[model samples]
Target: MLLGMRDDEEMGRITLAQVAERAGVSISTVSKVLNGRQDVAAPTRVKVERLLEAHAYRRTTRSAREAPLIEIVFHELESIWAMELIRGVENVAKAHNAGVVLTESGTRHAPGPEWMEAMLQRRPLGVVLVFSTLPTEVKQQLRSRSIPFVIIDPAGDPDPDVPSVGSANWNGGLAATRHLIEHGHRRIGIVTGPEDMLCSRARLDGYRSAMTMAGLEVDPDLILFGDFHVEGGYDRATEMLSRPHPPTAIFAGSDLQALGVLEAARAHGLRVPQDLSVVGYDDVSIARWASPALTTVHQPLRRMAEEATQMLMRLRAEEPVSTRLELATSLIVRKSTASAPTGSPAGRGGARS
Candidate 1:
């Protein structure tokens, strides 16, 4: 009954019951409007929304607003790369006085509809997606509910309307390739992520660009495509090294892949930098722990995650944010690479057991 009366008891007190009464509707109807539920009749919804704006019926309390909860979804939860991204998001969430919820998609790079349904039910302040994509229907649902979202290192080409944060992958690839070229490696091999992934394509393009600039004929026999994982790297490296004229150096699309390459070298009894050189992308923590610390292109995965969270915060506050953000990538030089051997021996038939 505390509609618009000014009294000490009712001061700044606007409850859903009062709103429902004033709008000539039930409390459930008011809830439907608040939740952006489409089941309600258009006229009833319009009346309820109009009254809500007039009386300013905020759904969140002061405490809830102060420490809003946010959600981050990822394709997988394994590996140091994912951990670094999580740490970055946690840091920003702490600074913003927000709490974070993590969800694993449990599927291919795209989050399924069940994940969207859960997110809608929880109604977090905003969402951050890493290496995942949303379906058009899910995007519409989020929009109807006024839930903002940002993507980090999207698995594919994101919708133009979606906001995203990523590193300069092409530049990273180019730099990694050029570093080997500078060290006198002409027959350089490359193992990249899936061919369908945008990041993989960009990195591969960058390598091609660098090779073209150096006037090195890209050897089709040395280029391989696989997932950005250790196994992929191992398989690709093993196959390439067993060729008739194996590459003197190899560029892996990820740190995990680089480790696999190292294992492949060992299995072949070839010493790193002595028989072959290697470069990797994403200077994850494990890179430093590798035998000959990885020479890599620093993708700044943590920074990208942090920036994406900040952008989501801005969106949650109804503030402006850039549609897309690209952080700079740098080359981290380590001991993994060396000048191509003066008298390179022909490739053996295959790696040793």
Candidate 2:
């Protein structure tokens, strides 16, 4: 048996000295790699990581000096749902007496390498990521250190190997569209999120499904993909409103986009509900305070975050957890949506053949 090494039934009996020898590196180098030190050469780190993984190595020891922290990383901190997610993580972290660390880095796909290096060094209790996917190396490094992670994937797309928390995006979309249809709006338009995101596609599919079920002819021109931002919403709404026979109602994929649609309607001299009804998704705070309070789908952002943080704790405890947890989405009706205008092309009686 090697010094400071003990047999772990689950982690297997791999000693640090054995790993160092196989990787052609000193035991100290292997230790640095395990601790996520950036001073080691790239080749050496990769070799050590492979050996550790091959040996099914797990770091069972915890440093007494380590801080109790729960880290949450996001690609964009400016998102409207960011505060809700933060609040959720904070709620759980506070309960466990662990501090929460927020980091904004990387793209929609994954966090940056620098962030990874820093995170490994910090050695937080676990991690909660808002990204849809994580790189394989990042996953391996975290596993090698026995660090747990859960993805708060609002995009509704997550890597197969990683655990995740997401809402019913497709159901949200369907509910939003069905609400419009029930209000006698037949010529409805949809402005969903970016085409590349699975969440966007899922919502769009929901919209299509609702329209089909209502016996409404879905005009391809009325469907637009947005950036889930006010600008994209405004631009898309403007394009759709300018058409010869525009939609009598529009469903903006997000609250931010809904605000843009409201502005677009105002610019076109259309009275909401009376002239053109509007609906939005993700009932963020702004949705309620809009000129005509938005009728939107209440995506449980905070709850999703809470569940994700809880999952991280479960993982840390080596408890069995579901690979994917999907929560339900409900619609909140307000002043923005109403019956279609009597004079509109697809008014109350305008069910498509």
Candidate 3:
């Protein structure tokens, strides 16, 4: 009877660990219940929550760390685009004297369970996910832990509750296509990334809109899906060039793909701007260094990264942040694009007239 009374007192002054023991579950399970995670079974959640309320258990809160660190996660670490993002974030992070930790999830745009577990264990001041999505349960856990996070260039349509930063992809695409149209090229081809990607879809829509406004038919054959890689761009460009009615100009989804397109034209003994014109997206460093400086849509990747970092800092301060932020995009015309050659769709065919 004395032991039973002591056990009751222990349950009454419960900590998370003690709550877990009383509920016959793991510490993480108790945490899930407290975080309001949807994955937990309804009955278990209810029972655990009831016990928590009965005990008047309040989670212990800790003061903010003196030297808080921020975590930055990437889908892929390669490419000038990723470098620019890192530079931007580092610039802002230094200003706040916050240490930055960078990690890559291999080729995946989303972090795995292991990554999530480690993140929860470390509990950084804030997290920045580049071109990635956060699962609902993970978001809940972060919220419960008082960890703030921001998504940069979300891979797809982000949840309404998720804060995100991105460029005006549709406007960039429209401007690129319009530049080609104004150059008198009616046989324009486009190589875009996976259709499931929101940015890809938006760019494609922008391309179609520009073509429609110019009263040009958008041939299904001229639109190709690519993996947003150099090899994919080369292969797609090669295949399109072999078509019976090939395009006079091409828009590659990324600068790396544009480089491949350039190589593909070279393999066919076609001179850039002379025989085949090309335009690219994301005016990374290579865009300017290419033999014929690339004509591209500048997505302001660095600025976007900096903006996302600033927003995350604000979030960590318990300040309100805008749910969506979009940076402007501009078209940079270079030597890569020119008027269509003779006998091409917009040349002797008189599409320009």
Candidate 4:
């Protein structure tokens, strides 16, 4: 009605009457602003801003973009093993023009002065924790500050509200275990990750599920829990093999752990596949080069790292995303696994009766 608009409500879309009623402003006041009147006071300007935001106004080219600062906290930065993950995360952050600050918490000095104050003072766009187990107090502090976060290998439900992105750890574990089962190996065993890691438990659950699905009853004695590194894998594998009727097939929860298992098997005069078939989660680069070409489940490390970066950027923009992001997992077959060894269990065990 004001500017060559149609008289019908639907023809030209929402009318001033509708807008005025929704905004709780007088029709005359709306007219003054529409007609380029300069008589509005400070309160009216504030009201207009609120209305625009409530209506979900899309930002046009002129809106200034805020430069976001992101923090990546790690428990251990000195390990060469963690470098690949760091590279993936840092590369993604740089591509988005976001500032990345790296800090090692729970280090020598007990995270004394510097770490506690970092998140609260800067109020970063989001925090990315790379396979670091954060203490409960630290988690609560972040939540209290209303900070968003993504954890790579966190121990528990990251936060009821914040979104998290990581590879399908449980499924990865299942896939690795299933591959061993498919190759006619029973006596399947596991060398797990740290007890505190949700990933460790998830993988263990997957192993149990896979065995159950195969109609095989799991022997609690066959389960060996350990750390994520190669040494931990070796130690746990040794314990499993020491048992009288040790596992003929072993599933190591991580690639590093798998390497250790391989070594332990060799030390006991056992040949891979011929002696003990091995399957490993996390098909890291070294998995292929390991003796007998270690068969493993491939986790998308770079992809997961990239996703964490992207999620942080979107959250900073107050954008929408899935609360629980899960990635795909697949099993990769290699020489490390083969037909069940002769004289071992069969169908429910390895080769023989």
Candidate 5:
């Protein structure tokens, strides 16, 4: 439709009204008939179809396409954080006067060598993978085909040699947990990310490291697993809270999980910070307004994304690039955490360690 297409000034572009006038029919009649609106008379549909072919107006939009297109492929389209990641990719791509072809992997049909071959044949400016959902074989196929690409959340050994970027999630977990510990809390709990995700594993390691460093006993019973989602967090939180001796300070690996924990807290009639201290990773926008402002670890989302895509552009320009980029993570201390209750499992009631 001309409404969503490009046009040339010199062509004296035809208008729908003109088409209607030329066709000797009312504007609505032409639109309904041409659009197959189902409300048009059978004879009117035939006349509009004929007139459309005669005008050769099929290609309604026109534009001077100058920039080259770069393919930005994501592992999955439905991930909660993919949109922000995409916006970051688009920011750099558009700034450099390049186009972006967004596609995905991990569906009913897995990617294969043939798909990689087709993508290589196009010779895109570069490939930016938001995440690696494809199998190792597919990745190797892309590499062997000499395709240029960078990994954001790279999957297994996702070309340790190529430029890769992501949140410093391990440090995020450390910071989140350390904040609770520093506030005189000992019974700290952790909700881990997916077992297969290196990010989640790193975060879990950080949590254990922080606990070990503080000389606090890491109770395996206090740790749970979630898939980095609100619902997962909700389920895990409910399950953990059902325990006879629940933790005094719970650290969720993501903001959504933290939200789920908040709901779970309400379900159990536990007030945040008053009865339980909570912390979350990923200081998303909603973290600010949660019942008690969330004390979360902040992932440098905009900067990380900007830097990653910018690195992709640099690679396209034949510039030498580093293979690994580690961004810093920080704690955004808010209202959700407080000193451990006098009788809480944290050290308040225990003998000196």
Candidate 6:
């Protein structure tokens, strides 16, 4: 039994008074730590956290004044997929008659301390994060307040400790590469996302697998890391096209980067699909609007967000939810890709610049 627990008290319920007494602190101090007040010293916070963890403390009741709001935090609000994710969260929040609060805070890893403090003050019904991982302190703060959170991780890498939703990044990469191979692209180049992200690595591995399966040589020089943006795509594509034996097809990894590839091809006086076939990932809204459309991988971004929001609701209701959910990705073929050009270099077992 806990030091301050009475025999008549509930088995798992620990009151603030009991926790305060055990920690040798006043009730107000405990309250400050619970509310994520910055005034609390680091040592005091750590001590309180340890005590709370040991006792398995959980806030059983929410204040009546707390608004019916669901908060969605993003590292970058300007991302192309942000609107789709926001719409998904809004759809679920509307069904529950709850307002959706959107905040752009923190890095790709976790929300910052300022965001955590403000979130505790708001005391939303639940939270939806567009990050792969959360700091231990952030996780503890949310759990201590009984604030459920779910991550919509597009990176295909999820934190083992939390519930997350992602898509099949490896499958998407394999599908994209195979599609190019089917179009007779023997010498294919890939501009995958950043090197540090697992999704990028997974996709690159998938590309490699497809190439090996197709009896194609995986040239190191044909592979480039991109920032998943237009400029990165353009720069990488331009460099590849400049090579003596340029690839017949280029998988730009992202729709925005694919757009860059198209721009680079145009600047080099190369016609898309005719001179250089292009493929992209993430069939976003602008994919179909592109000049020749984009042959890309369709990542279920909105569905992932919707599922993450639903998981939050399940968590709030004390219902069972999967720790991780990975959705399937499909190839969306459009006008941008075609058979490798003939007579130039494709027929000669090489690629044209």
C-alpha TM-score for every candidate: 0.80, 0.92, 0.81, 0.70, 0.71, 0.90
Task: Estimate candidate 4's alpha-carbon lDDT, on a 0 to 1 scale.
Answer: 0.68
Top-scoring candidate (lDDT): 2
Give lDDT tens digits, candidate 6, residues 1-353: 11222432567667788989988888888888887777988988788888877766777666675679999999999899999899999989998999999999988788877888888888898999999888887887787777889999998788899999999999999999999899888889999999999999989999999999999999999999999999999999999888877888899879999999999888888888888889899899999999889999999888888899899888877778999999999999999999988876533332234
Model 5 misplaced stretches (Cα beyond 4 Å): 1-67, 107-123, 133-147, 154-157, 346-353
For each candidate in turn, give its C-alpha RMSD to the true structure in angstroms. 7.3, 4.1, 8.1, 11.5, 13.9, 3.8
lDDT of 5 by residue, 23-142 (tens): 788888865543325577767756665655554343342213213666776657766566677777778878978777777754422443334544544556567776544455444434
For model 1, residues 292-316, the per-residue Cα lDDT tens digits are 9999999888898899899887876
Query: What are the lDDT figures for the candidates, one per model?
Result: 0.80, 0.88, 0.80, 0.68, 0.70, 0.87
* TM-score, ranked from best to worst: 2, 6, 3, 1, 5, 4
Model 5 CA lDDT for position 42: 69
Q: Over the stretch 100-143, how does candidate 2's per-residue lDDT look in tens digits?
A: 99999998788988888888889898899999889987787777
lDDT per residue as tens, model 3, 77-167:
8756788888888889999887788888734546665566566656566788875566665565555455677888734466567788888
Q: Looking at candidate 5, what is the lDDT of residue 218?
A: 92
- Candidate 4, residue 270: the lDDT equals 79
- Over 243-286, each residue of candidate 4 has an lDDT whose tens digit, in order, gives 77788889997888889999888877778878789888777778
Q: Give the better candidate number (3 or 5) by TM-score.
A: 3
lDDT for 54 in candidate 5 is 53
Model 2, stretches more than 4 Å misplaced?
A: 1-13, 344-353
Lowest summed lDDT over 10 consecutive residues: which window, candidate 5? 58-67
Identify the runs in model 4 with alpha carbons over 4 angstroms from their true place.
Answer: 1-69, 78-81, 107-113, 116-125, 131-148, 154-157, 346-353
